[model samples]
Target: MTANACAPTYSLPATSAPLPAPKQDPVRTLIDELLAEQQRLQTPVARFSEAHDRGASPALEPLYRDLIPLSKPGPGEQYAFEVDLDSCTGCKACVAGCHSLNGLDDEETWRDVGMLVGGTRNHPFQQTVTSACHHCADPGCLNGCPVLAYEKDPVTGIVRHLDDQCIGCQYCILKCPYDVPKYNDRLGIVRKCDMCHSRLAVGEAPACVQACPTQAIKIVTVTTHLNGQPALDTTAFLPGAPAPEYTQPTTRYTSSKPLPAEIIAADAATLRPQHPHWPLVFMLTLMPMAVGCFTVAACADLLAPRYPLLANLPASAPTTLALTGWLAGAAGLFASVFHLGQPLRAWRVFLGLRKSWLSREAVIFGPWFGLATATAAVPLASQLGLFSGSADVPVGSVSSALASAYSLLAAHYSLLTLATASVGLLGLFCSSMIYIDTQRHLWRAAQTIPRFFGSGAVLGFAILFAAAPTLPYFFALLGSVLFKLAIEARELRPLDSDDDTPTASFKTAQMLTGPLRLPHNLRVTSALLACILAFALTRISAPSLLAWTIPALLLASELTERYLYFRAVVAPKMPGVVSK
Candidate 1:
């Protein structure tokens, strides 16, 4: 067929004609039309819309209306949280409502639901706990804030944060046992649930209370009890919640069913050390070093006149010490500014001096820095002859008059030196008290005071010996390190006393001997090597290299030690969930 004329001619196939439409049955058409008509006739149903949903419905109106009076009571009454444990279904609707209604960050939640589990294997049990801010009668966050950012409503007893006043120090976070105040890093302030005060003022229920389908949460008026009547019973708190006696939280947990004695928070077993505060670490370490150097140098200068051996000390020694101390002090002060969220407003730090240790620290350090500068300036001024009498002296001036200028300058130098030394010591005392006032058991004055002073003394001697080699200073360096090591050795063992929190104490001990083992060993090794170098090299013919190396080593070692102190100490806090 392919030969010559039989070859096939390719062409597109002719398009197929469209098939005729199938006819529909009359009864089927009638049924389709009926279904369409029925759908069209039915009323439009309301669908869920988070934007339009205010959680207001006919069924919720009566329940929430009854709660309105409790939230907006008369002068003698105060608002408080009321929860019905039996009605809670762990649906987390309240959490969603709070986050959505408050316009909060997606990850930030003002309310949380936790599960408490207990009972024997034969009778396993579980209960859901929904908790938010209690607006405590004596809110620890309020009392602990250095800037007075938190205040309790005199009329409603709702604890509210003054965002404008906060510096985001987060001390309130440490102080609050309920762990309610949440730090907002973006705003550099702490925020918490204020019991939806604005809504309560406008006669609306809180988001949580309104959103709960099971009517688990309510608002109530808790009359201010007279003569110290306890506001809460033993069962008012979920097991492992912080004791109410401490903060006097006003939230009420109600359940008709008996909670098992063994019931405990799911997070009770978790224990970890506090997060590292690097700014505080640097501030603390450098401050003592500066104070030590200045005080020792001032004392040495004062004694130079009385002691012949001291008079023989190098002329550059005191000058070098004063200058180094001034530099260290300035660096420390700068480091402290970084710890404040509003460092530009650091001028306000002195405002709370009457009641806040943090304020006192600023007050004391301010003058301490001023005096330290004056002490350093005196020598420079004398060398420049700015304060020294003119070489000519007045032609008619008497001999005493000529001596008067020199005497005045001398008195100014001595007085300035003594003041700087005194203020520096006082500043150290104030620094220690800042942590002590938090009532954290680990930061007691007894432990911190010695540590601060001992570190100052050790670092001072090490630096001095490095600058100017001396037998006595070398011995002093050895003694201080030995004593300091002995003191720190006590922390290596777990605390077993009743007054201490067993888990926290043991955790601190374990950190010291476990995760921190390598750093701790390195610090010890560096310190011992420095000591050995000092002892061995002090006798060598050319010891100039030892001058800088020994103190540098000692400084590094002390820095390591301070890091451990901050990292190992366990602060009391709410139960934290342990991650699997």
Candidate 2:
């Protein structure tokens, strides 16, 4: 304090210190603000611009509406997917039959047959499995569908697609190991056996079921099969059969003897052979990158304390950022490559602009992938070897400049990836918006995060967790599961909504706290008491009961929460019932 009194006033360092800055132009401010508004406006425009996103094209809706209700077995129309290993030759005749009748293209096979070889008789022991859709008791297809495009009749339980309403997300196909939903890139829609809806409406059998000359397939009600009837005893009802996990498909088939258990096992193994290839690869690629990506994100947060400053970050953070940003994206592209049957002709994938997220996903990621690569490599080169002894050393060297540019580019991709998630969320939002316009409180409410993030967190974790330490080499998966579980679990905790968001997921927490809470409470209390009695039991019980115990508690609580969300809210269709 005394120093001020002793010091003479130095002229305000007037080599002309920069003046205190004035407020910038409001026009500039508005323009800067418009950046995001510009983005929002561009999204709808981009959707319209895409050839495949048809996005309810007035032109296409009528065309789809014309094909609506699909020529299905109709609601409750019993349909069968039968295989005659004995009389049936692996001719793929039913496959071709389904195509011709359904107007499916060369790539789209409504039905296909596989060979299951078992029994001591070597070559002759092979049985042919010609299946379209098993229409299972639990159609994994129905449970996994995000758009709610699938509906099974309560009476007969025939699963059908609401063609006009379906967004063609391909999630149903992803859920079905059998790969029943066939995507038509030309139309950007999924084509599958609708149980010959039009024919079934008239009490006629579906094309494929009828086409089976050996009479291997027969359409029947769900009750007939689940009754522990003879139908369940046949080869048609073998373990791992095409039986869907949720829909309780009404279609039924008959067999002579449920082949020897070994043969049945072999046949079940043969039927659904499409092991998901991406999770393993993504785990390998993504896990390592998550470490890098997070480091990049975290470091950037530290260095750049502000928005523009983030753009000016050093190379190390960008390298990490770029690589991490690209991991999921590049992996997703790789996954899409394998998802298609003829990946060589993948260029044709882009041709359908009016109706494909797969296409949009492909389109968006292409540039994002390139930037991710260059950003990662250039920065890395400078960091390691590119600028060892230059005048500018590392920071001001030509290589460094290039590195900085790439680093910034990578950040943009990160933003774009967020945009992609937002786009997808919005697509789901559109699904909700569509339902809202209908005044359907059920769908309107169901439109919340549970459908996207909840289901995504659950299924993604399940898929991603398969690679957990005992699961896989990558923590990319486990970390995400933990992160998502932590965040989403919290989101599911509070029951907040008005029509505000429909059934609150937090209600699931309530269920766990109230009605369903007792079992877990007992388990927890008993476990605590048991620990006092014997700690060994806790370890033994945890893996066996508690592994599932925690997951089940969470899942049951969550699924019920989701179900309550679905059931409690009344849609306009079911008039006079108000949401509880």
**Least accurate 10 contiguous residues by lDDT in model 2:** 570-579
lDDT of 2 at 223: 36
Which residues of candidate 1, in runs, are more than 4 Å off?
1-63, 66-77, 115-126, 223-235, 257-264, 301-312, 380-409, 495-502
- Report lDDT (Cα) of residue 499, candidate 2: 32
Which ranges of candidate 2 are over 4 A from the true structure?
1-93, 121-124, 164-169, 224-236, 239-251, 264-580
Q: How many steric clashes does model 2 contain?
A: 34
Residue-level lDDT of model 1, residues 71-160, one tens digit each, is 355554578888898988888888888898898886688898877777999998787778899888778888777777788898888899
Error of 1 at 245 (Å): 4.0
Backbone clash count for every predicted candidate, in the order shown:
0, 34
Give each model's whole-structure lDDT.
0.75, 0.45
For 1-580, candidate 2 gives per-residue lDDT tens digits of 6998989886665565778899867565776878868655532223334524656542343222111233343332444554445566666656766788788787778676665545666534556666666665556556554445567665545567766544554546645545577776776556577767666665455666545545555555433353343233233353434333323443333456555544432322111112223432332233223323433344344445565545554444455444444564466456545444334445643433333334443454455455445545654655565544443455555566665665565466445434433443333333333223323223344344333344333333332222121222123333433443454335334544433222324334444455545543543353233223222322343343332232233333333334333333322100011112
TM-score of 2: 0.38
**Candidate with maximal TM-score:** 1
For residue 141, model 1's alpha carbon misses the true position, in angstroms, by 2.0
